[model samples]
Target: MYINLHNMQAIIALACGVLILIMPKLLNYIVALYLIILGVMGIVRF
Candidate 1:
């Protein structure tokens, strides 16, 4: 099961979306983490 970077990101986004729907409060943390991850990925170019 080799998942590419894009697929992994998609799965993460889907999970986060479902979690946000279940617990709206998680939105803040999820968004924050997402942004942080994006920044890191951008810097690392991965």
Candidate 2:
């Protein structure tokens, strides 16, 4: 399956939201990692 950039980001955001809801303590790390990954992906165009 080939998912587009928007869809992939949405999925990741949703997953991170769920994880944050489940474990509030990880909210900071989850958001940070998500942003970092998005940045890297944008740079690499992957």
Candidate 3:
């Protein structure tokens, strides 16, 4: 039950990729949100 940032990012990215493949229209939002989240996580280091 202990996940590091890199692992979390990979999981999220994988989920997003699957979602994009299914929907195709959410590519922009998913990528943007992913970047924002990754940036925040990187800065906060939480």
Better of 2 and 3 by lDDT: 3
- Give the local distance difference test score of model 2: 0.88
Give the alpha-carbon lDDT of every model. Answer: 0.96, 0.88, 0.89
10 residues in a row with least lDDT, candidate 1: 37-46
| TM-score of every model versus the real structure | 0.85, 0.79, 0.79
| Candidate 3 lDDT (Cα, 0 to 1) | 0.89
**lDDT tens per residue, model 2, 1-46:** 8898888888988998899889999998997898898799878975
lDDT of 3 by residue, 1-46 (tens): 8898778878998999899999999999998998898799778986
lDDT of 1 by residue, 23-46 (tens): 999999999999999899999996
Which ranking of candidates, highest lDDT first?
1, 3, 2
Position 34, candidate 2: lDDT: 82
Q: How many residue pairs clash per model?
A: 0, 0, 0
Candidate scoring better on lDDT of 1 and 2: 1
